[model samples]
Every structure is written in structure tokens, then in C-alpha cells.
Target: MSELNHVPRRPLIAAFLSLCCGPLGQLYAGRGKRSVTLAVVTLVLMIVAAPIALWIPGGHVSFKLLMFAFACWPVFLIVDAFQCARKARQQRLHWYQRWWLYPLVFLAYLGPVSLISELRTVFIAEAFLIPTGSMHPTITPGDRILVNKLGSRDDVIDYGNVVVYYSKGPGSPLYVTRVVALEGDTIEIRDESVFVNGKQISEPYAAFDGELPTYPNMVSMQPVVVPPRHFFALSDSRRRSMDSRMLGPVPIDYFQGVASRIFWSRPRQIDFSVSPENSQIGAIAWERIGMPIR
Candidate 1:
């Protein structure tokens, strides 16, 4: 007599496990060798994708294609696991194939994966959703941005660099604006014209939003020297940007990172009519997706 018990694998169980993590479904279906191979492949793909998604400067369309490929891969794995389970004959269960081992294995894998992801978010890059149009034409409301936390080095920051930083203090919320003045530079605003070190700097991205004459009081400021280890930032939407003008010069340590690109964006309502089926609702701003932030 055989020493082990033979039992049929459930297709639904296999599919669900695959959905959780690529190789898991195959493991449940008693394909130990295939599951190990799939696990290695999936791990390699994730390691490759992370750096490309964060640092590579590809075309907006190409970035979307990468995202689409990643989304489709899991679906392929799930389907494969389901079909394999359906065709698999009853087989002797090994020690690793115990019913209790499934969830235990999942938890063991999930713990380390979650930890690495959280570490990356804290020290490398993080995604943010724009809730206001303070940056306006440069960064509109509903735009989802990727911020490079590793690129916030004070030495690399320069005039016109868009940065994300703390609003007031270490524990405060983050704000995004363009750097206009560096440490030890004299910065002034006269009639909405910016001057760094007494020379008026070009501001092609600046916008008045048709309210130029209305905020005359807020548009001009006397010359102010940026202190050591500090920088001045302002919004492109001069008429209504709550930037360094309101918050004052920001300390270098307060900076979180540089705004990298628009990973995703929600479409404006005026661009398309609403559909009864809600198809148009929550539509994406396709043109802005993957656009780099200068």
C-alpha cells in the first residue's frame, strides 16, 4: 500500500492561491517543480520592474504598456493554475502539500514582501494624489504623481526643480512647488516677476489665471535673503499658490523629494460628457499619464 493519501486539487482553491502570488496555485496543484520555477520568474520580474518604473524615462505610452503588461501577467498565472488544477489527477500529497501549509506559506512570503515595499516607500519613492490645483497648469487636481525620495539631495536641487516637502514641520503634510532660490541667494518678487541675486529670472511656466491685477498685494515682495541650508519655492499658479510666500523659506531637511512624473491622472469633467452607464465616470487623463515633471 502507498504510504501517502491521494486527493484531487480544487480548481477554485488553486486559482485563488495563484491570484495571491504567482507560484502558489501550482504548488497547491502538486506541481512542485513548476511552482518553484514560476516563483523565481515572478520574483525576477518584480525586481526588474521596480527600478524601471521608478528611474527609467520612457515615453508616456511606453510606461502605460509596462503597466498593462504587469497587470496581465497575474491574470495569465491565475488562469494557468485553474486549468492545471482541472486537468490534474489525484496524486499523493507530500509533506509540503499539507492543507495547513498553504496559508502558512502565504503568510511567510507576504511578511517579507510587505516589509520591502514599505521600506521602499519610506526611503526611495512614493505615490501621491493631487487634491488641489495650487500648481495648476504644471500639476492639476487629480493628477497622481511619483516622487523620488532618493533624489532630494540638497546639492542636486537647482532653480526650477519641482520638489515635494513638508509644509511647516517634520510631522506636517507635504507640499509640492518649484524651487526659485537656493541657499545664500537673494530672492524677490516684483509685480509677479521673480529675481534671484538681483537679476530677474525667466518664468515661462508662471500663470496669472486672469487674476493678475486682483492679487497685486500678494504678487510683490521686498528682497529676502535665503538663509543657509534653506531654499525658496513658489507655485506656477501665481494667483493662488500657497507656497514659500505663505510658508516662508524651507529648511533643506524638510524636503521630502523631487516630483518625478505623473503616473496617472483623472480626466477633467468638461472634456467628456457623462454616460448613464457610468463608463465616463472616473475616466483617466490619458494625455497626462506618465508625463515627466520638469
Candidate 2:
């Protein structure tokens, strides 16, 4: 046997590569076939599991189980890669084993997985943290909520649904607000009261600090007609919200999804107009946890 074949593979490098890029570690350990197989399996599992998980009824425990399975793919790959590298280091290799085909196989396997992951983020549900009181009363600061990326795609986004959308500028944070008006609807706000299509719409969930009305801003003139493929959103706490009144109507393409539910909530000094001056201990807002956002 050649001297090169007698040398042990570097398990640490393999592990690190796996951590950085899925299945790359297998290639590093000269296991091209294993790397390709693992990558293909991981991608297939993720692609198949995501829609199944999302389709499961939200109330069922199996939904969470499926989601857990989808999320564990990365962990599974990492651990398997580490173990494969460790075992490969223990075994003597033939000179022919370390071939250029390994890296090519790794790249071939990685491309599809990366593409699927990106598509999943765009078309599936994703978690988001509420960092401001812009959507207060419906969503609070420190609350973790799930955004259903497929919500609007599958069904018509109706009035009064809370939606998560992208901001206009590059690198802008996602904004969550209530859909008050849809395409072709006429919207007007008088003395903080919302009127849609010439009728006053009752909003029981709307929060107001006092008798203060919606401030006169750039978009707060006589009835504004919502354009085609656009929506008007407002904060539940209207007095403090910087929503469509300030940002203008949001295009349909900008929408990410509708806010589904509060998965977690922590009691912090929320920046609402009526927040308490001091934070409290054991401050988890238990009532808000698992509360579905309407």
C-alpha cells in the first residue's frame, strides 16, 4: 500500500466542514457515495415533510411532531457526518479512494438541498419575534409568533386578518399589521374610527390609549381607494401605529404571510403607550401563550 493510504483521515476537518455545509464532511473523509446519499435523503425528507407538516391540523399534536421531524434534518446530517468521519479515520483507505469525484458529488448534492430550503422558507411557515408594540393588543413585544407563508396563497386574505409583510427597503425588518382594507375598497378614518366601504367596521380588538384620534398624516385624507393588488393595514393600537397611514398601501407582492398564533410570550416592559414603568418577575405572559391570532 502507498504511504498516503496509510495516513488517517482528519475527522475534525470533516466535522467542521459538515457543520458549515451539509454532507461536505463525508466528501472530506473520501466517502463520496455516502455524502451524496445523505444529501439526497436529507433533501427528500425535508421536501416531503414540510408540506405534510403544514397540512396537518394546527390543533393536532402530530403537526408539531411532523414539524419537529422537519427541523431535525440538519441535526441528523451533522451527527451522521461526524460519526462517518470518525469511523473513516479508523479504517485504512486505498490510494484510489481519495478521488476528485467526491467534491463534485458533494456540490451536486448540495445544490438541490439549498434550493429546496430557500423554497421552503418562501412557501411554508416561519417563526418571527415581535420586537415592537406596533401591532399591540394583537401582538406584543417579546412575543414569538408563527407566520403562515402559505396562508394568503391558499385562501383569500380577508379583512381584519393580521398579516406579516416585507418592508419596502432593502434589509428592512418584517412588519406585522392588521389588514383593514383590500383591493378596490374605500377606507377612511375619522376620529380614530375605521370606516370601510362607507360603513363603520367594528374592531373590538383595537386598542386606544385615550380618546385621541388617528393622527392626521400623509395618507389620512378623504376616503382612499385601495388599488389593485394592494392592501391597507393598520396597527391595533392606532394612535401609536406607523402603518399604511405613513407607509402607504402595501403591494400584494410584499406580503410574506398571515400571523397565525402566539407560540411564546414573555412579559417585558412592552413599549406600548400604557406600559408599566418597571418590569416584573416571573414575567411570562401565560395568557398570551398559544393564543391564536385572529
Q: What lDDT would each prediction earn against the true structure?
A: 0.80, 0.73
Model 2, span 1-294: residue lDDT tens: 552555577777777777777877776676768876877777778777645543456453554555567668777767777777778776766544565755665677667877887888778767787777667778877888877777554264678889887778436777889999999999997767788999999999888764455456532457889999899998887766678987888888788888876766884564335563334333677667657787
Question: Candidate 1 residues 1-294, lDDT tens each?
Answer: 322477888999999999987778988887778887877777666656655776666669888888898889889889989987887756676657777888887887677567767877887788998766668798987789988877547665778989988999799988999999999999888888888999999888888874454543368888889999999999887776688877789999898888888888994422213431222226678999878888
- Residue-level lDDT for 133 in candidate 1: 62
Candidate 1 residue spans exceeding 4 A from truth: 1-3, 210-217, 268-282
* Model 2 poorest 10 in a row by lDDT: 271-280
